[model samples]
Target: MAVYTEPTDEELATLLNAWGLDGLRNFKGIAEGIQNSNFLIEVRQGRFILTIYEKSVVLDDLPFYLGLTETAANAGLPAARPIRTQDGEMVQMIRGKPTSLCTFLDGVSSQHPPSSQTRAAGAALAQLHLALADYPQKRPNDLGPHNWSELWAGRAAHSEDLEPGIAPSIDQDLKEFAANWPRDLPRGIIHADLFPDNVLFLGDRVNGLIDFYFACEDFLAYDLAVMLNAWCFEANGREFDLVKGRALIMGYETVRPLSQSERNALPLLARGAALRFFLTRLVDWVTPMDGALVRKKDPRDYAARLAFHRNARSAADYGAPE
Candidate 1:
């Protein structure tokens, strides 16, 4: 979360008044993520996070995101629960932007997670999928395979500029994913962006999962694919660490075993996951927002990952059991 819109003390006070929270001790902008403006808010009762939604998040989709986290939290998942206003509204508006207050979860994000931590993350993610198995609400994966072409449109040169011959490789990967994307895998709510920054860890345990803005109904294995790219890869974003990948998949399977079909489709799913992030990052690099307090991630990181996944023939390539 980044500070794109700066709200004053009086404005914050008025907003907190609606929630019956008084005496704002302190508030500070969080500069970790790229999508929303987040602030750590302290009041008489306790600490909370005030998130101001920025661009790319549809205002209409707020309820689904909030409900997903609420459901997950209620089901005993370590997820941040939404705080409702006195009027029972989970979403509010501040400075003409959609906003909400979420209970602060205690833990720190690990930038370079060890194998043990990855194992816990994998188990936690599987537990999250199980918790949302019967979630009544459903939201489409807006950034799924079908939307990649549009996101990649007009960005070929940008890819080539970053590295020669990368554009054609990306184009070929997109076509292959479109033609071979899985159809009948287990489907449910997925935390599409389950990167380390989005998960809080207290030692070896996963304290909480945050930033459900990208959560949507999609292939369950696809979430694992996202994690493979997110947690199993080294910090340099070049090589995929087999040891870490094995620990993560084993931990996940302990909670929810993968079917043979899911295992067979994992390599393709991993490629798709890498492509999704690469395309989005490329777009952001090409057409960046001016004066926005957001960091444009290096798309080349995902590009290197995509190149690696291209040669992967099975889940074993990611250190999963054959």
Candidate 2:
């Protein structure tokens, strides 16, 4: 969702030829996310997205990512399907980087989503989980709790510079999570980072879910927890919106209800989710890529979310039905 590599006209022509597409009308670099170099291209066949894998996406993992997305799309989900080249390979090379082309999904991503849209997003997420229940392929959550400490190592002073005395609390969170992270919850493929910008909406319905780069095998309820921290938060990231929270959970239940164990473990899972985002954002904040056309998200936002989650007592605190 960023553009570090700019493909030249000849390269674009070669790519289009490889894909058997012609009449390239327009092309432009997308400059939103931090992971990959993305471009929007319109050809004779149709509009499409071209993603050049950057450092964060491992080259070997492309199959899992692309295949999972293809599975979701095949199941009638609004996921962008990866377009194979004329040789039937899902990936190609551009400037020595692993590159891909996917069908362009049609909808606009919301910046400040309403409760109705949040509700739809929740339902879409559940639908995704159900769609991939027997997906067989598994990619471990590389950014899960086990890796947080490594990501958090030696950045306490830098964290303090952003917000005074916040790093100690983050450390405490890590300890608490280590002692009590959930073990026996129902696990499945999860869109681990389904933030507002990742979901596209038309009216109150979810039209598409993009950015499956962070997708992995994890607790199904943990996916909901990620959404809670993402969609139900106020703009300032300090206050939780109860109405939106209730709507989101209720919407998700319409597709797939949470088990009792999942319900019981929500608060801890939420704290862990918030911590995961905070730590990653902290890392990116402290040491940004030199030439990437990407935005360095504020780690303090998730720091605020972590504070809220620390005080949450149970599932009801997140507007889950009792």
Candidate 3:
């Protein structure tokens, strides 16, 4: 349902021909994403994912994303490699929009992943962090704490309409995060959006991580916090699953151990992660894209998550060993 642009057979053949790929057998619009128009392209050569940048994605940041994924793939990470055309361009114009082709990864995304899968996801994330440790390119997190206030501007009334007391809660969260946002945490490239749908699994292991569109440089622990909010919680987003959280943390630490400072900051970072998702979802809910084949995720789900994070005083609350 995320296909906003429909490419014709002729167009497909022309595009593939430019890349020196033979015979476009078939292609179909992929429905799993909300931010971009995607198609699963099958040709005489191989399978690839063709992504057309939507209005939401900034055109200038495409290189950083493409480069990061390419770097991760080159470093032996299970990431989809961006394919270059005969002209050596990884990105090209198609259908009057910036588009790119990436080698298709084989796996399925799970909505209700088991704890073992959660552990694998954590390990995968840590592996991603390590893989990008020496990556020279840097893109600042556009949705980091500094930008949250701007995103919340003029949305108080909309928040109130969604739920009576929600506006005040959000305002308080904004103030708290701004005041307590950690400044000295270790920084690196992070998949700022690592939700369940962005990760693919083959049996119990992670097959690949996709959607580098939101990759950025930020606090490394904050990335783990985002994963915890994403993978360790129940589907309803109201309850935390301690066992899953423990497994995930253990798996991550096996690759990259958290410093004491990072451990101390996890609760606050988790709260910020919940708020980031909540604000984005709230904005989407209030001003949805017209005629877009995308589902509007309920903002209240992250609202419930925000409430839980507020009361979590330490990493121990998230099943971290004391």
* Per-model RMSD to reference: 1.8, 1.8, 1.6
Per-residue alpha-carbon lDDT of model 2 for 179-265, expressed as tens digits? 999899999999999998899887887878898888999999999999999999987689999998998999999999988888889
Ranking by TM-score: 3, 2, 1
**Count of clashing residue pairs in every prediction:** 1, 0, 1
Query: Judged by TM-score relative to the true structure, which candidate is superior, 1 or 3?
Result: 3
Residue 165 CA error for candidate 3 (Å)?
2.3
lDDT for 23 in candidate 1 is 74
Model 2: per-residue Cα lDDT at residue 106: 85
- Write candidate 1's Cα lDDT for 166-213 as tens digits: 988878888788788889999999999999998899999899899888
- The lDDT of model 2 is 0.89
Task: List lDDT for all candidates, in order.
Answer: 0.90, 0.89, 0.88
**Candidate 3 total steric clashes:** 1
